[model samples]
Target: MNGTDTRSELEDYLRRVRVALADLPADELAEVMEDVEPNVLEAFEETGSIEELTKRLGTPEAYAEELRTAGGYPPAPSAPTRTVGDRFSARYVVWVTGFSIVVGFFTGTVGGGRYASDRYVVLMLCAPILALALWLLFSGRVRRVDIESLREYQAARRTGRSAVAQLPPNVVEYLRSMQPAWWLVRVVLLGVAFIAALSVSSEAFLLIGLLIAGLVWAGFRVRQDRRVLPVVLVANAFAVGMAVALLSAVISDADSSRSPYVTADYRGSGLWFDGEPLDNIYAVDAQGRQISKFYLYDGTGRPLVSRGDSCEPSGSDLTNEYPKPEVDYTQGGCTTSTNMPVLPLPPTAPVSVSPSTSVSPSTSVPSSAPETAPGSTPPAPTTTG
Candidate 1:
């Protein structure tokens, strides 16, 4: 009975110690717990009574306080209170506006077709922020304090221990040697992801966020222990994966639009394929007359033609005053018969005649002798075989 009571008392004391140090970082809390637990358990084993243990070791609260002092941790706030609801202010307003702008730009560039459900994009972006704000507003304030010292202490301890015991000396030296270069790489990656997220589109946020989160996770882990190479690998993998995804998206769009829009060029313009004897080539000379015999050329300026099977004529687009013929060559083949509509030409200037070298005629010539002098005998025609 006495032993059971002592065990319960010891357990309760340990619980109290943990509760008191709850506000400390996870690593610090764990370290304190590890050191205190075994010592207390051993004391209990020998003493066989809670009263005797406390007489020598003091109360659990005092022990926890001593641990904090030794560990260089500040005391937690006694009356820390939670603040209900975060306010909607300039920062959030800016975030929301930026998000909207990104979405608007994306829609405009990608094909701003009206949809019955276009409102969904706005909802998706705003709802999360709104929910977070509401949560902060409704939730009561809680005690919070700067945890930098605890984190630093924990990191230092972890680094020392890991260097000596977990990793080989050569490996530790190698990691230390590479630290400066790694810092540069990290900064570059973070900058790229951040800039891309802002400039490209809101859809990039998810990818960028993932990359940033990975970077943060890896950074924290590396601070804790240099043996955390797995975290670093995973973070860099995310960056590479995101880059590949962006490239793939671009390539897919290019492949899909190859025939419809522009073709890839040596300069990598990726504009419409002007390389052809296509039917719809339109150009104007200095004289303001349309060039009718314009021809398509290869890179070397040689003519080329499509010998593919006959393709079915696609429907015509009559949006302009003059209609254009649209063709789908996916089925049969390519053709120069794609009669794209001609755009209206600009007005031409009247041909101005310089002063005549000879005296100007009073009236215009009839172009032929007047009707045989009003009934004179008609001239005979001469024929030759």
Candidate 2:
């Protein structure tokens, strides 16, 4: 082959070596390539042929393996043969992971009131499944190669590297330095989540304890075993989801409590008395005669407008008018009553007068008896049967 063809073959060999070493850190891979390119070029020039170079240096895959060993790197992971048991074990892990995600979502959405106790039971039941998954992971039943080969895993790995590469070196270093702090933070967050879970059901204390233990174990093992990364990510995702759920629940409760009586736009403003919405207002004169129509105002003289109920066909318009028609709906149709007096007024009692005191025609007697002069004892008032 001509020199150009030999150079092409040499380039192809270097490409394969780089592909083999792609899993290495970017800086380390670059260093390895720097050392590799010079040595390969010199060897190719001396050999004068790609065939001779292959015979001397072995195939690209073998050469890369030798370099890995010399550099004290882990050997390349081999694709595991998918025997029936291995396939079953892998499927089991996948199903358990999916189950965990579903349970997490469910707990986040309905983790209160009557459902709280049930959630703890569900969590307790899930402990065995989670423990089984951990066992499989630690026992090597689920191969690391299988995880690395997943399309989502590979895509995530590439995306993470790309993102890190885009960041400034100082920023990256700062992030790396904060990793230990992050581990502690995540543990604290998980602990809080566990406490929240415990509050719902004391029965699931064991399950929560198990989960916290697993999280700590995973954190410790992640450096030695990359397989633990997915677990850590899942646990963190769950903690975040639970936090969002709790925040939403609190906001929703607050809104529900206040929404019926008041709102941001004042559209929901209504007459509320003693923590309850007042549907209607009734008015009566001093003689107990019902006043059918009247307008209400506050001490400041602003109209006391309240949201009208279904009895008023007009949309949510505020009204100060009293004695709104009481509305009731039945299967037949709706009925309304403008009944003025809902309660009966007692009979008025006659006023008593003292025989000794004579009132002038222009003088007006007070409704209540006038105070007795000085210290004189007054006669007891009589009551009609």
Candidate 3:
């Protein structure tokens, strides 16, 4: 093969090794790329062909692995799993769950014959997040960066220090000074996400709790398993999706069927239907306070006309036999549109008897007055004119 062809092949092989180790920390990756390229070029020079070099050195990935092991590197951290099958399965679950959450949000917003604009809002909110997730999954970033070796990461760190040293001293100091602020920012972000997830729905308590547990587990295992980041990404996506959906709900002024206040769900009485009064009736507001007039809609959202009426009690005499006056409802007449008003009990009136008619207790009482033996005849009564 021509020198140009050999060099091109050697470059391609080195590129593959770089790609394989791309998930390593940035400094570590740079170190690996720097180390691998020289060795492959030297091998290519002796072998005179890419095929012969590969046969002697193995595939680029295998070659990288050998180099990593010989250099005392740790195996690349991965998502906490045993095999590729487990890794991909977990990723698939994450994707499905994310999409499900988005769909659920949309359906929950507009499921019950809601306004068309609400559907549009749902689409707008979810489409961008889904598109980004798809791009992350398929663009080879998540799929390609899983396997790495951490040997000689110390050297990588030294290189990072050197790079930082090259920056202006003041710039470096400024960055160092911001470290605490950066940590605070991270804490605040996590705190907001956690609070938002818990606050969004009582029904999601278990799910949110599980997600927090997973996050904690993944955090501890992240350095050992490269796939943990993918899991974290998925979890963060779910959390952010929930937060967004909840915020949208709050901001949209959507009427909630389950509002804590009864006033929100109060439907006017069936006094009117379809922009006309069903019958001549007085209207009251949601608080049960009477309104001279009110406009309302029926269950099907048809507008109804309201009638004006006096809520005050009428002047008609209420007989004690009935205990309440019966109201006569007619056009331009007194009407009782609400529950009956409770009337106060009447006061007792003092009774007066004429002195001439007064009788002593002994004379008036049958037991005490004119008590005689059963055998004795009763005295004849005399009448005074």
Candidate 4:
């Protein structure tokens, strides 16, 4: 038998011994102490002296053990009890750790290199809302049915297992099924699951949050209450920030016009040859590329309008406005519109300048003049002055 379970014979003998030696109390007590003390000192097996023996007896606990052994008694039993608060705190720690991991992973993934990615915004904005909804649904109404509310439940008494199970399904499951084997599997699954869900949504945190909310909702119905509001709330918060970033990106992305907001012509001003058009004049080659070719009434075939460097737009010297339809009188050029005047010279009329005279002729002529223009009569010719 264990020493703690004292035999009835030993107890009876000790009591009879005590009663039989009743005459001299001090001597009796001394005799009992002497007999038992040596036995205690011998148990350790190396007692040099009383001082050594007393030193070996560390404290009251050791002394009590010695007393219990000498008295032939069983050791007093300990209380087998745990408080509710300690259990609740342990569960809270696990839940918070798991939830933070999920939230942080999604926030980074969905934000991508830039949260401007449209899909990321969608996911980040919505995830939180989904979490809150799941909490409300699973927690069962705004007011929780705490044990305090129950008629039979009392702070004075221990609460029943059924009452604890009445907590959110997630809480119940954690308390009930949180075995080491299951926890190992869950931590791995959840770690990967958080990543997979975030990745699967293409880092679209809002969408992933929405998807998680659905999962949370369904889980609550199926009694998976550990799927709490906090995780879902984390996911949803990511969704919201992403959405705001996206909106800001869109708003801030002002589309500046690539084409000049206000366009003016090239002014087409430059030097020309015999076949070249005058400054600011329009001339099309067979392919319709504007050629500077134009016929000038002057002896030298310079561009007719705005011929020299002195040539400038008739109006605003700044030249900021749309090119005004100037007659191009300085050099003589046509406007872009077809309805504008045609300045073609006939071949028959030749420009004659007196080589002796410095002045050149003013007008041009057609090379072959007899052909009729569509609706016009031929102009009368003037004799030289």
Relative to the true structure, how large is the alpha-carbon lDDT of every model?
Answer: 0.46, 0.63, 0.47, 0.39
User: Each model's TM-score?
Assistant: 0.26, 0.53, 0.27, 0.22
TM-score of 4: 0.22
Tens digits of lDDT, candidate 2, 147-208: 54455556755787667667776787787889888778667756766676666666644555
Could you tell me how far off, in angstroms, the CA of residue 383 lies in candidate 1 after the best superposition?
Answer: 22
Error of 3 at 147 (Å): 11
Model 3: CA > 4 A from native: 1-66, 72-203, 219-224, 249-385
Tell me the lDDT of candidate 3.
0.47
Displacement of residue 279 (Cα, Å) in model 4 is: 22
Writing each residue's lDDT as its tens digit, candidate 4 over 299-321 gives 34432233232233443332211
Question: Could you tell me the lDDT of residue 297 within candidate 4?
Answer: 30
Comparing 2 with 4 on lDDT, the higher-scoring candidate is 2
Q: 1-385 in candidate 3: lDDT tens per residue?
A: 5433454477678767766555555546656666666788788779877889999999988887787787677765564334665355435534544465555444433322223334434433443554454444444444433322222333543576568757776686688789656444434444554454354443243344544565567666554343445445445555455456556666654555445344322223223223342334333333334344444433333333222234454333211111122344664766544433432232123224332331112112323222234444333324222
| RMSD of every prediction | 18.6, 12.7, 22.4, 27.1
The number of the candidate with the highest lDDT is 2
Q: Name the lDDT value of residue 186 in candidate 4.
A: 34
Residue 295 miss distance in model 4 (angstroms):
20
